[model samples]
Target: MGLLRKAARAMLSLSLATRPAVADTEIDKHSVDVAATARAFAQAAPLAIGDSYDYAPGVQGEADAEGRIGDTDFKLRLFGAWDAQDEERRYADIRQASLHWRHDRLSLGAGVGTFFWGVSESINVVNVLNQADLRQAVDSKEKMGQTFVSLGLRFGNGELSLFYLPTFREREFPERPAFGLPVSQRALFETPDKGGDIALRGLFYAGDLEAGLGYFKGTRRSPLLIRRSPTATEWTPFYIETENLLLDALYLLHEATLKLEAKTGRELDQGFFAANVGIEYPVYSLPGGIQELSLIAEYLVDDRGERAETLGQNDLFIGLRTSFGDIGNSSFRGVVSYDFDSQGNYLDLGLEHRLSDYFRFETRALVFLNAGRDDNWLYPVRNEDFIEFKLHYSF
Candidate 1:
């Protein structure tokens, strides 16, 4: 691996230093990024799930490169991860590979890429362009790439964009049953395998406020779990045809920021609504050389309430972020989420520090509280609290 990286760097430098002049096409600029991480979890596997080690080890790597030449630009990214305990967790993905062209107010792009479309931090109900990569994490924030052709028209204060996606990626899961329920490997889709989707969005910017309006019609990224047969003990993912209207906005107010994201959609032939509203307020110059402290709070609401298919239904999330302003760039974040209906709570704590110029260290802890009731979504994993540590190297 070291030899390959050295060769790649030498070739890139040689190509840039010894390029031939061509038809007035300016060889603009290029950049490359590579990183790797070693991680471990200090948690024991539940006997009900399977036999596993008291500690789990994992590794991850990613590389990205981008360049711009004249009126066209291109980007590529690759990522892979492997864990010792689960075969399903060992996989690689092409997160992005695309070419984009722009002239005046019009722009076009083609290829596979990942897209993000929400302003809230806790949860984003409007981000549906790419499929979720659940094997990597349970937050549903990670995503797989999608093949698409996109066009955009820029105006005075806004841009109108349209996307035509030609492919769909299925969700991934662990071999062991999640929450002690059996899950099948096969997935069902309402549309044909190749039947793609379409989306349109308009973004506007004015002073301290940023807002967007979006519409999507196609396969639902979030699937409904259904029994494969009447008597079967296993469940399969079922992706249904759906349509959604999305709204997201951010407004700056002095030392604080206001964020709002809301979506109303039709999935599984039923209408649903969800929203997240939050605020971020920062206080500078605390005691004991503390550089800053940020307070984050958000409220999550879903019309389905306790029967929602996912977590964060009628819950409140509060977080505190501390920056030390030290040479190692140390920071810490702590969060607590409380379920209003179930009276359950979740706690998360994270700390990060740069060990050296090329190395970084991070640690995180997750705990569940008052989740003994089976009706609560977190009940199955209530005893699955764990702490994780990671070391990252980048160049």
Candidate 2:
């Protein structure tokens, strides 16, 4: 880790000396857009046997604006969602508000933004720049914007990026009464008090292969839960009403990618290593005009062993995607992830079809299989299988 830090500093110093001059040419443009969605969700199983079925209705609105002014670019995005069944699920957030400046091979950015890194299908162990927005989804596919200042330098066949994150963001969670973990199990979150975080990443492209290496030193976005009350009783198989659980932890991450991906992180007290290797291939034009079918497979492994909580220790993810290259630009995707250690599995299916230039229809379903007590992450929400339908309109 010390060597990594020294290397990052050296790269930064070298890049600073080679900063390119800004161009005098001016190109300014700006546009604003808004989107709204109405969604409905239905649970596949009762929270309790004989209990009433759970249903939820939700609506979301998003506003976005972006433009370029000379050598600088700016973007802003805001989102709000309302859920009738879950108060915790109803929230508003500033997804992005950032400005970027580029001069030849050098680029710099600041403000709140979101970044996705890594090449894994089911999990993103190497992508930690933003906090997970669990209020929207438990799959970790959604991310909250993070405030940071970043600098990037492009040289040779690679680019190096340095980030100084000045603020820490915590992961959002579903309300205590939600189908997932109970409120009592909620961790007591504390904001970090000292200097924030620092991260560095280098990405290189060679032939048809792309690779990246990343390092992060600072607070962990995901908190670790510590039982506060030892005598709390379980009210249901899925819900436990414990008084308060302390959730605080920090860690360092070292990740590398080679067409495939690998990651390792160390908490203040413990550490774990993880990896994912996958391939994606597409078959063009089946009977339909300009249609394509894509196949994907990724194997995941984590060395946290039985103690792993959020991530599956060992799993395989297989996915298929179909693109109907018609006027509507419709698509369908399905993924099945199986945990080798616990023999538990889940399937995710999604379909999206553009009805017109201004409207679209989408639906998603998550189904769990054999997610029993032996399962690490899925055991808590074993019965919360659900399907959601949504209609979105943009203007």
Candidate 3:
């Protein structure tokens, strides 16, 4: 009967067989429609047991490649000029071939392929060095497998899970990447089972909160930190990770992470912790039904001064998400973050577009600006720029 109500019905007419009516003064039909759409989406989305891949091969023209290593043999501008002439490119092989299968109570997944791993990083320093860059110095392709066996207990509100990771390969530790490693070590990039290793991730959940703890005791040396200073070039850090997350739709959520590692040479023990808490609100609509808004603020601490002294002093990132119209998942989101007392200041802008039930594409650009001269900047003094582009697909 009203103009706005008619608009919502018009939009729903395209998909729903009948426009569900709402109690004029009790609840909004739009909220009902939104909730219905969410349920439909959750039911139609691709299952966890599926195969997919991504190729994020790009270039980093000039990244202070010659700053501390060999400044004389190569002038700073030479690397910059080389970048201008021919930048470095990477072929991630996002994934190789993989298979998935899921039943009412159990699910399994395995693959021998290309995948991008979020190497355990010191959260304090947001740009200490990318995990890809770290692994690039050792191994290229990492074989990955995961299994989820859940049993609905506690009146269908609680579940349990188990995960596994096998020993893959090591990175090509070039004497000095300035030159490059020999063909022998580079060949190890694709090797599998050359060593023995196993990792376990156990999770327990109920209602809106969950707790998880994991351990990795492997022989393969995949140290997340490698220090190469003139005074002491040490290879310390084997592997370690500790993390947890709590998620809720209508109330509140909290997430936290802490990592510890012991290296081969220095035998240094390093770690850091990050925690965040947020609020959520559920809203019903005038046309369909369920809609919601969420806000979160995160804080991180890095105590890896023994390894990468320039890792992180402190870090914070906040995000806001909203859903509307006939959309199923979140239709739009915006984020703001402040980090790096070293390289000056950094900001990120991102956008996500859903193509279908099995595919999605997203692009984000980060800009770095030197806030001031030397001592004033909390980060390193590198006039470098970083940009990341990615696409996700589930079969």
Provide the TM-score for each candidate, comma-separated. Answer: 0.85, 0.79, 0.44
Q: Which stretches of candidate 2 lie over 4 Å from their true place?
A: 1-53, 176-181, 184-195, 233-259, 306-311
Candidate 2: clashing pairs of residues: none
Clashes by residue pair, model 1: none
Model 3, which residues run further than 4 Å from truth? Answer: 1-164, 169-195, 219-293, 306-313, 323-332, 339-345, 354-362, 370-382, 386-395
**For residues 290-356, could you state the per-residue lDDT of candidate 3 as single tens digits?**
2555454544433343233222334455665555445654354554545544334445455566667
Worst 10 residues of 2 by lDDT: 240-249
Off by over 4 Å in 1: 1-50, 193-195, 229-231, 305-310, 372-376
Tens-place lDDT digits, model 2, residues 1-395: 33224333433443344442345333343333443443344443334322334676778878877765444666777788887756666887767776677788989877677888876667766777777887766687888877777899999998999988776655555642233334343345433252267888888766555677788876666555444556543222121111111111111122222236666666545666767776666665377644777787878887866544345778888998887856528899999988888889888899998888778888888777668687767776666567777788777
Q: Whose TM-score is greatest here? A: 1
Write one digit per residue (lDDT tens) for candidate 1, span 112-182. Answer: 68899988767787888988887765567789877777889999999999998866676777642254455
Q: Rank the candidates by TM-score, best first.
A: 1, 2, 3
- For each candidate in the order shown, give its overall lDDT on alpha carbons: 0.73, 0.64, 0.31
